[model samples]
Target chain A: MGRLSDRAAFEQYAAQAEQRWETLWSGDRWVISVGISECSIAKGALETYRHLELLLSDGHIPAVLRRVGCAGWCFAEPFVEIKLPGQPPIVYGWVTTDRVPDLLDALRRGELRPEWALGVRAGESWQGIPALRDHPFLRSQRRLLLEQAGIIDPESIDDYIATGGYRAFLKALFEMTPEEVVNEVKTSNLRGRGGAGFPTGIKWESGRRTPAWPKYVVVNSHEGEPNVFKDRRLLETNPHLVLEGLLIGCYALETPHGYNYIGGEHALALRRFQKAVEQAYELGLLGDNILGSGFSCHVRVRTGGGAYICGEGSALMYAIMGQRGQPRTKPPRSVEEGLWKRPTVLNNTETFASIPAIIRNGGSWYAALGTKESTGTKLVTMQGPVRYLGVAEIELGMPMRQLIFEVFGGLRDGYRFKGVQTGGVSAGPLREEELDVPVDFDALTPLGAMLGSGGFVVFDDTVCAVDFARYLVAFSRYESCGKCTPCRLGTPALVEILDRIRHGFGRPEDLDVIQYASKHIIDLSLCGLGQVAPMPLLGMLERFREEFIEHITERRCRAGVCPMTAAAPIAS
Target chain B: MEPTKSGQRVDLEPLRRVLEERFRPRDYREAQELVVGACQEAQRLFGWVPPEAAQLIAEHLGVTTNRIYGLLTFYADFRTEPPGRHFLWICHGAACYVAGAGRLVEFLQERYGITGQGTTPDGALTVHVFNGCLGVCDLAPFAQLDHHEYVGRLNLERLQALIAELQGEAQTEAADGSTE
Candidate 1:
């Protein structure tokens, strides 16, 4: 591997190497790839991998087993991709340990199982499985961040390199200076997708400026949003991309240590990440002087106990310090004093995953893709009433209506779209009137919603706003760290009032009580959880007050979704 | 692979070892504390009283099982098995019960083969009659399964269907041999 020390030299090397690399992997070899993403792991892909390893112990097979990330067909996991000489690579899904024997038999006999065959690979096609690409759930997706997912073995550096993995990192570290790297990110205008929407370049610069002995970079992989699986899907499917991004960050900041704070409940992801971290260390990509550069960096994995509040930056810092996962008051922001009192820059998994691409393509190229406010692509986890319910990456400022209808196939069963819940539990619910609103921090914030996290839960006409508000509050309340009075106590009161309202209890004044409490909680809370705790209730109240009034005064739920109100007699 | 004797009690020592190895900068004591917290969380998910779950966690954590067990029993969320496939927790505190939670519970009893505090004959549902504020008072009478909210009023038919749906999913996963 030749090294280039500038962009011009790097471009020349890349141009020459692209042709050479393509020729090398085009040779005859048996490629047996398995989707070992978190969902697949849950379906016992690890055991299947072990079985395959044992079965192929003899050299007669001449096959290499590789573990790739998710392929978006979560409903059918443990997908297997087989590439044999003179045959188009094929992918089979819904695989289990029991099915492995059958799969092996078919492979040996050169027979195909039509039922299991998801699709076929046609010369490096993204949609290896034709059916899967046409599947109602995946047809609308335009994969960018997930480009190499389900294609390359995440743990195998060779597989990653074979698919143009470290090329970006190499170009960034060896060719571009730290200042240039930072400048590219600045030009990209890529704001943080982790709720706050802070500029990534600004954060990097701020942390880089500190006179601290050692700066820290943390990948906030601890996704705790209910009904959201975007981050989880990314980490499960493309662990290496996230790692490469982290490595690029390390190089850009000249930091020595990085931490991936995985959610405690995500056992499968933890296992894969733990293995990936170890593999990175073994390959000398992690510890001490990576790729023969004087720069040295190592990444460690930390598991956070199931605390929703810990998803907040301050609380995440607390958990990393081995404290009870609780939020800390900000003033001495994390960039100044974080993780054992060090200058730390914490960005979400997706945020870090974008870094390598931004570096590879240059900032100007990346910035030109999305809206001015929100640059680059955004990975959104679509859930609930949507038909094509999965994760997809779309350009920022894409229309909410297009995302709901064109991308997610609209409300399931053609149910009228009532509203959409963006940014998970803490995000304010937006009505149909706001459906055309462009997705960006500036637009969403004024509408009393923040692009907290890229999680969109669609609701149909059948959904009851009163009920929905209550559900979110209950989730936030239970997950609260109880570090502050507003979140700890105020939330329960709001829950009680909502319960009363939903159960046909009378009191016009109770609405006033809810309004007062919601305002106070949002204003006085110490952290993001408390600040956003009242969002669901207040949003529902403002947008659908008639429903709440109907549940109380009329003793009936128009949606017929609420139990107490549903049982009430219909008006003549 | 050998099973340790029960009287011997699996130790929490290994948890500390694993934690210390993973968190290199942290000392053994700090590692043990972190492991304890993680174990406590795992116990809550299982809906079991912490002591037994803690012992198992101690084994994973490489610490004395007794030490882990002690920590488990200390937490509020940790529960010993009340024994039910569906952990039906109805909020019966001042807010919920006042807002017709009692009627909802009665409705559940009349419709499904459930009691106030026991599992159904087939172990499909376990209706735990407890009291707590489910936080969304403005909307009241709430119930949850494994901490995931199923809010917005409750009725006999909906409760039955919810239970059946959960049981069906569980059975399907089990039949596929995808779940432990």
Candidate 2:
């Protein structure tokens, strides 16, 4: 291959070095990348890794074992991928330690066991085996944000570079003016994936136009929303991408300081991101005078003390500033006054992660991929009772029916679909009839639902709507920051009524009180946490009024989830 | 409110020394930046922030002790009372809850005889501290022992096995310490 003469020899040298290293590690020898996720660990995946490594070190196998992050198809974790010379890499799932010998035997014989094989990766289908893209779990997904997940060595910057990473950041820095980059994003119509569906371009423009010096760009990587692990996945599996996006955002907004506030509970993700930050700094992609473009930026990777309100923009800023993570009163929005009262731009983990790709492929190209209103793919976590429960990246506006049935392979076992709590705990539940609704921000908004961070938690026939609603309300009550009266008092009051109804002590007026409280909480709460807290309960009441009535009149919970219905009364 | 083994109140001098070395703040507002940091340091040292820690930090920052306590109580990760040797954080996120994290929480509470989201009676474990989301929804019903290690796709049986394993480890460590 002739080297392109347009670039300097050093660029070519770096590219060749990375290519040679990848080929040496992957192409000629057995390269085994095992998926290291918490799910896999629960299934004794670390033991399996140790066994494999032991075998390799003992000269029983000629292979390399690299620990990678989540494969996303989590139902079949303890996932392993093996690359043999002159052959496509083969992925296998549910790899127990006992199966290690069999796997190694297959590798030695140049044959794959079809029983454990998920599939060869796309464009590399060996024999008659289907491609990974053709797998039933993955077929409907349009994986944009999750493009390199489970396929690359997340720790290796060279591996990421070999797969065409960081080009977008370089292009943004050298080629495009800050205004042009902002306009391109605006033209792309990329909305904030961190709920509210605010246009990213407009948010950036606001930060840019704000007449404040030392503007800050913050990444909200705290995935505290219930059932939402997509941000953690991105941070752990492809941290460099998130870093690149942050760098690109800084370049666009002309901000010199950036902070990635990660959840403290996520130790692995935090460590991975910390390492990626160090790598970026070492590469001169971060720190002062980044890439010698006269544009300098430094990113601080801070960990949150596990407050859900810290996911809120203003609260996140306060947490970064080492204060109590209570929501700030608006009018001076985060864009105008944030992070020590500077003009700061805050975006979610997935939103910032999507920036690099948006810069790489032109704004219009990304805009054309998804629906007109919701332009771009969204990474959604489909957990609870699904056959293949994990995160999937789907083009925005894909029907909920298609996602539930086609992508997730429907609910596990014989469990009939009861309902789903889309977005986070805050968003209302959608019934079986509402499954046809497009999983878009605007479309779900009118239904009193939102695509908030794309947590699609499916419920089965065994789930009691009352118990589930009580659980969500209780969660909100417990997690409320209590800065304002509505959230502090209102959430506890809502929980009390919900708890009373679940305990079969509901007065009919309690329902009205709940409804009244829901409206007022939404109206009076100062922050998004308190505002959206009532939606789940309200949604459950609206859709499953019979469930509430059954609990009240019949004093029977069909799903057998409520304690009072199942047992005798406690001393009250 | 816990007393020392020698039948005296636990000394705050060592803790004060550590805090002084780690963070010597000049003023109250300036110390706001070290609120989370100080709490983390306290957690690392004592496994939880005692009332004395609040007082010490408040004094160091030139703020009211209530302010330090307010910040500590606001963040969920900070524990006030001393925990058992191990902290068990179960994610009751929508997915994990639906995948039986509720059952796990119930089972631990019932089996270990713990209540009110605190340490077990024997101080072997803290059973009922629920986390927001472990961010590993792919592994539903995720559980974390201590603050670092993750155990996912947890059922009661697996949780039982993990707890037993932790108890065993703690026993071994105790034995080693006593011998020393």
Candidate 3:
């Protein structure tokens, strides 16, 4: 424990909190935490809260209502979990304001509606519903970063601290040396989850070796990845973990200054993170001489200007320096020469959020969890026809088949899984035959795919591969920073050819042009955005070549998605 | 380069002073920070960075106007022209596309005669130029009215209702011109 007794007091308080769990289950106080998200808010979560408030004012309902982040079951939002004394907490899904009175009445009667009951947790079953973890969607998930999600008040640092939040930082400060911390991370075998899978330990060691005054650490919370929400959810639910990780990185790198670059459009996430920062400062976890350990660090939250390129390391540094969001040429990577021409360390939100756990439990323990190459769990955002639409943290190397069919309950009605796109718009599609592929970075790399930001979307048979290719291609084209010629010109040309192919005007020669443009774009682009610009088109061409040929020869889209520009096929 | 107006030349002191205060420039080394400060101030104060405002920031920070303009243009959030009373952002992410966000975009374009990013002729709304993803993939086909407020699961009827609400609010604001 530190001199302030803060750590000791917190540990005691956490113990007390754990002890109070029995009280919560067997006492008079009833707690209800609604899983709140942008989706839940739109689904009238606020309305439900207001209805509860009205009930409370009427002196009818005798329970406290609290807001929590997404419970990883977004399909069930607005989710509500009710805890009554001496009984298992019953969770309800798809709850609405109109159902509040009935729910409260049932709760008053010590009963729950079976149809609405999703799960119960008290080492007992209720209405045929099993434990929350027993749900197929959550069974295989290894919740590390999201352990406290939908359970704690994110705005309350005391809640976070009482749950053993900053103990890892304290441990890093008092118990271990900076190099020891780096070695521990190395021992954990934690690779960067920021698509690249670079070793976190190596990045830190390099930054440590470089002697520079005022070295910098940056938290890349600018999650502009097309369909990924893991970072946003983590920030919204438990920002302190990320902050702790950033502090750890700072300590390891001996950097005094840090920056958290968040997307400007992420209003809720930004608000929650800002609140956490303020509370951390108030609790002395941040600011000068943090925890009286003589470790001083300052973290500034910089709102990104809504540029996707800013998510790139060098491009992000430029954005922070108030220049155009553009990437720098490599040979001297960001670790050596970064923001303000100083050695800098940058890690994604998920990579940073996992630090506390790695430090608390020995790094070797973490190393033993996942596969040989990729250690620890990965957060994946599942979309498309999956039954459950939410973020889940699963042990890496889990087969995509089990992730989609078993966990997400497979495709929805009238949909057969035709293909799945992992790693956002950049990575190529994996056909149904390739569903058994393990979702680790190295495993997917040989197939011309990467676990790029872990945005996985499943497509049905009805989905036009050509049209979907255009959609992903369009995202890359729109987001390309026009600094480089390959991305600037090549992506547009790719788009033009794709547009023509989709609209039934593609010539036999267009396919050759596409392959040519794609190869050149990957080879000549200045940055990742440009380099990956041709991926969607090329990936679709490689995997779904027949779809393109159908559009060209038959002048008929098998999925009926493309519009016909002319009645007859174009001259060969 | 933009020609300076007489009034702007005479009254550049207010904007210049604000830029200086925002940047806290110790010397020319801190010129880069001024670009962000100027852009943020312009968006917050004037709703857009006019060429004159960029010039003011440039002079105050001891940098060229092109430098400041380069940043404003490069960033998607910054706008050079004034926006209407309200702004709406309809996400076009992969999830949104799968959930029929294209229909919503087409609906907005055909009914309201607005395509991409444009201000309504009535000056009631200015939609962004592109239907960029706003990171709310869970709520596929979600839109942000103003900046912070999210409205999700949008359909034609729901979008019409939202537009009506916006138009009504704008009318009320116009009627009570004294209230900003």
Candidate closest to the true structure, highest lDDT: 2
lDDT of 3 by residue, A64-95 (tens): 77887876777888888888765677889888
Name the runs in model 1 displaced over 4 angstroms: A1-32, A40-66, A75-84, A90-120, A123-142, A414-416, A565-572, B1-180
lDDT of 3 by residue, B1-180 (tens): 222222443344556667656567665645774467567766766666777778777777778888888888888888877777888888877777777676677677787777667777767777873434665656677888776577877877898888788778888887898775
- After superposition, which runs of candidate 3 have C-alpha atoms over 4 Å from their true positions? A1-27, A568-572, B1-38, B41-47, B50-65, B106-115, B129-132, B155-180
For every candidate, C-alpha RMSD to the true structure in Å:
8.3, 4.0, 4.1
lDDT string for model 2 (A149-185, tens) is 8877678776677778878988888899999889888
Better of 2 and 3 by lDDT: 2
Candidate 2 lDDT over residue span B1-180, tens digit each? 322222235567767787789677665544776667777766777677777767777777666777777778777778777777787888788877887777777776687755437766666677655657766666677777776676777888998888888788778877898999
Query: What is the descending TM-score order?
Result: 2, 3, 1
Residue A571 alpha-carbon offset, candidate 2, angstroms: 9.4
Which rank order by lDDT, best down to worst? Answer: 2, 3, 1
lDDT of 1 by residue, A197-264 (tens): 89999988888888786788999988777655667777766777888889888877888888888876
The fnat of each candidate, in order, is: 0.02, 0.74, 0.51
**Each model's TM-score, in the order given?**
0.76, 0.91, 0.91
